[model samples]
Target: MRTVFKNFLVLAVMLGTFTSFANEMLEVTPTFNYVTKGNHISVSDAFGEVIYSGEINYSGNLTTLFDFTQLKNGKYDVEVTNGFRIDISTIEVKNNIVFVTDANRKTIFKPVVRNENNSVLISKLALDGEKMDVELFYEGELIYTETIDGEDVLNRVYKLDKTLKGSYTTVIKSNDRVFVKNFRI
Candidate 1:
């Protein structure tokens, strides 16, 4: 009876440890839909090749840097998974901008600027209750700034100044995070 009780106690402890590890939630911050450096993350290309992987070292806000500055622009799958739960984000990097979405192409935040009929069109979409500050800088000078309020889904389109002939930088701030993209006219 003593041996049986000891075995049972050991089993209970093992099960408890397994359960605790399995229940750990994997959180990707600055938006789970998009991944940059400083997030505990693993990135794979479309061919299932692991391009980048890193573990979070900091305690607060999941700030761990994973460098992708030398990578070529393309679609990649980012995985932030614990032992039990797996979260994947599909992202495309183009023109210094990272466009991120879920498996179903549901974007968390999407921003696009394109030339339309000799004019530049700037469009952005954000999730519900998300506040965004969009700023356009021309030649290092602030050209325009727009603050978007939180709504169920926020969408905005602005016509950019086509006459500003040079490289422009768009800075987007949302949810206490900032994203910068540079484009040329």
Candidate 2:
């Protein structure tokens, strides 16, 4: 009788363990819907073509659904952009099946560019130790280049030459992304 009781207890524990593991695995299953704290979201292809774009006008945990079935069998990127950072996730589609996981997500900080009068101020939060490249161009000619890193926040200010000025362009590059700002002095 004791042997039978022990076997039943062991079987019950095994079943409970299996159930817990299965529940954890299903937590990340792709339901094509999720709650986001972002304002704008977009889905793009591998060739840098935007497939779908939407804006979240309301606040709070709003659930959004993206239909991946309309897409072809390939890999795609979904980007959610707030004011300061962009969250990216790569989803794969195979044989009309969509796969997504929280492990395949990344965030990129965006540079803030402001042009006031003749002074240009650029600021970025350096989180992932990625080097930022600041380039200055005058009349389509690259004149200055500066690479910045090793700080919590990267801030740069350039006061343009008030005399020699027709058109000026400031290009900020970081984390394989580029931002261009143009101004006239």
Q: Count the backbone clashes (under 3 Å) in each candidate.
A: 2, 0
Candidate 1 TM-score versus the reference: 0.41
TM-score winner: 2
**TM-score against native, each model:** 0.41, 0.64
For model 1, the superposed segments whose C-alpha errors exceed 4 Å read 1-107
Error of 1 at 184 (Å): 1.2
The whole-model C-alpha lDDT of candidate 2 against the native structure comes to: 0.79
User: What is the C-alpha lDDT profile of model 1 across 13-101, one tens digit per residue?
Assistant: 99999999999998646555433334456788979899877775543422224444445788887766443234566777776566665
RMSD per model, one decimal: 15.8, 7.2
> Looking at model 1, which ten-residue stretch has the lowest summed lDDT?
58-67
Residue pairs with backbone atoms closer than 3 Å in model 1 (clashes): 38-64, 38-65
Candidate lDDT (C-alpha), each: 0.64, 0.79
